[model samples]
Target: MSTAAHSLSSNPWKQGAKDALPLLGGYIPVAVSFGLFSVQAGFGVLETILVSAFIYAGASQFLFVAMVVSGAPVWLVIVMTLLINSRHLVYGPNIAPYLQKDVRWLPLMHLLTDQIFALTLTRMPHMTPSDRLRWYVSAGVIAWLSWILGTALGAIAGDELIERWPLISEVLPFALPALFLVMVLPRCTDRRWTITMVMATTTAMLLKLFGFPNIAIPAAAICGALAYYAIQVRPTDKEERS
Candidate 1:
């Protein structure tokens, strides 16, 4: 790459770790909530940590535990996790071009989640390829560690916290969904994105009402992606009017 790119690439791992610090503000609470809920759903501390470690998809893990507690079958939980995480398919291609070709990518794939995905999208294009990888890996590692620690804390005290303040029991589960809304709302100022968001939410709700709750997320994702892609590929109304 160019000299400029080389300079920017320097200290990428450190910079990436530093940049990821802000994300902890959101990650810690949600992860701890997830841990507490996991215990409430009958998971032990070790089990909760393992889910955070291996699954690592925050919202999906939450949904998985919920489904399990509701007596949903194992197949249903697995399928829902797959459907919920399908969004990562979209996240992957966006960053693939900037990544180096290596085995390290395998582990990185496991680290991929909504927060890091969004973080990389904004920051990776500015980084050199080497720095991009360093930043990506380092940021992911920090998020991962923080999540585990938060989960441990939650598992330890989640029961007591919920017992003392019953409202917290109700509110903790919405943490990730609230975070999702915060992310989506900013982008909704664009008409096309507004339409896409409405379509996705409507599709999910309609599916759930129709007794397809388990498949609602994946179906809505497919519909929303197609709707947005169609809008993007089409000439704008101004172009057509012209």
Candidate 2:
């Protein structure tokens, strides 16, 4: 094996696409939905593709499309997008130890997004830092490509597709979250982490009921991290020493 090849996790763009291939196959419906919805909302192929490629954050992208479709104001759409993808901050620190081997913190955090962070941290812990970074860049950037292509296609071709396919609208919105679910389910071995996650999600639902859905996710995640540290970290640390 080439020392470089053996050193890194894998080529980032390639690894990302490879890992996401199965999920991407499933995501085509979701991508197509974005395309159709964007066109319906006055977005052309260019606008649709820009949102997918640049924003590259799934929940935000879908939420933006939903807002545009509802005839909402542009500012409201922006706020919603920011709120939906705010979890990237939390994802950054969790992966710091692994990436510390090569790059500094800012650059490491630069490429991170919610899904990419989760995918890499859970799956790439044992790989070379180069390979780990490669894997992350892989999924992040390629899924990004898939998103833009699908949206552009839908924007240009959505109405015709709906007239023909009919079922895609119901399914596309679920794609990114489904990919997240797949990533989340596999790495849930830490009981404390699992507890924190469930508690966070439950809290978000309750907060939403109280008329503050926009702030729920970050608030819940913060509270979960606090609760986990308070309840479990000390014991786990002590156990590790023995």
Candidate 3:
């Protein structure tokens, strides 16, 4: 092959797509489940598809559909959706250091999701800034397309399938958490991260047990981040002082 052809074939975009292939297994089923739930909750197929295309947030979209179905006020829905997605505030800063300064931020930010952020966090540190940007866009775009396609499929035919095979409705709900664990579990090999995960999980469970479930996730996240910083940074500072 010509050098140019070889270089093009090996580009970061291709690598990103290849790395993201595993996410399809996870994204599609969850997206389809979201579509099915949306339709069952009274959303039109077009509306379901549009939600996946536009909102593109997995858990938040589910929350949006539920709140809408329950006759939530417009302002309430907006506030709740933003609250659920506020994790992006953390995700953005964590991943920013790996990208080039000039990479257009809007498209990349719009496409950001938990899975994409996790994937990029692990992969981008080893790549050049330009390559990181390309890789991130490629992975994000592929993940986004799969989500939309899956939602379309479910919106069009999911209701009938659920009727024909009732167990499917039971199974689809688990797919999102399963997929998330698959993506995130590997990152726990680091001691500090593992500790943070434990702290977060414990905090979330305790909050839920105490009937404060609404704030559980965000509170757990904050607690876990604080724990990680304390464990990972304070010792370094002490050593420097010595």
Candidate 4:
């Protein structure tokens, strides 16, 4: 049949894998740092890998390691992990509409991370449903593998690397935020989104300045989302009333 459709059918997963390559640049170092930090924080090698494999969460993992090192109880750690990752509640629902209807998408939920979510959100609208699922899984596999590789490297060679290149370790902690910023800035091009982002950033910054860094993130997210909703819904209500 059609050339474009044939091309998509030929190797959609490979196209998905290619799209995910940019995220790898940020993910590897952050994940490597996770492994290295886990060791420094008293996790064994197997424990480090398993945590990366199972939790697959970046920020929550950092919090988990810190709490563990501080002698937090297991149940507390699990609860805190859930709290820190609760944003996934929002992320999951956002992407579910774009995913396959079958059971395969269920397990892929475990593969969801900030980078994967961002990548999917940006690209999925342009993809056919089948291609979207193929691309999502393909990109997710790359991200997952990269994290595992980074963790293994950190577990094995992290100490020596730290000794030789201390700044590399120092810079790793900033990678996740930078990656998020990169993803967000482009998506904020619309006027409504621009206003929402500004509101969120201002709110979050003010909170942080007032010594509430912990509360700043969720508050900002809520403020931004609500601001966008209000802006969007007001016009709809006006139209309906008229």
Which candidate number has the best TM-score? 3
TM-scores, each model vs. reference: 0.78, 0.76, 0.87, 0.86
Compose the digit string of candidate 3's lDDT tens values, residues 78-160: 99888767777777778877767774976668888878888888777666555777888888899999999989988889978
Assess each prediction's global lDDT (C-alpha) against the native.
Answer: 0.80, 0.68, 0.82, 0.82
Best by lDDT: 3
Pick out the ten consecutive residues of candidate 3 with the lowest summed lDDT.
1-10
Give the alpha carbon lDDT tens digit for every residue of 62-123 in model 4.
Answer: 78888889999999998877765766766777788877778988888887887788888877
Residues 91-198, model 1: lDDT tens digits: 677788878888889877888777777677667777866677778888989988988888987899877877788887677656655666665567676767788889
RMSD for each of the candidates: 4.1, 4.3, 4.4, 3.6
Query: Whole-model lDDT for model 2 versus the true structure?
Result: 0.68
lDDT of 3: 0.82
Worst 10 residues of 4 by lDDT: 1-10
Q: TM-score of the candidate numbered 3?
A: 0.87
Residue 54, model 2: Cα distance from true site in angstroms:
1.4
lDDT value for model 4:
0.82
Which ranges of candidate 2 are over 4 A from the true structure?
A: 1-16, 65-80, 100-111, 207-213, 216-220, 234-241
In candidate 2, what are the lDDT values of residues 106-161, reduced to their tens digit? 55454465566666765676566656666766666565666667777778878887
lDDT of the structure predicted as candidate 1: 0.80
| Alpha carbon deviation, residue 184, candidate 1 (Å) | 4.7
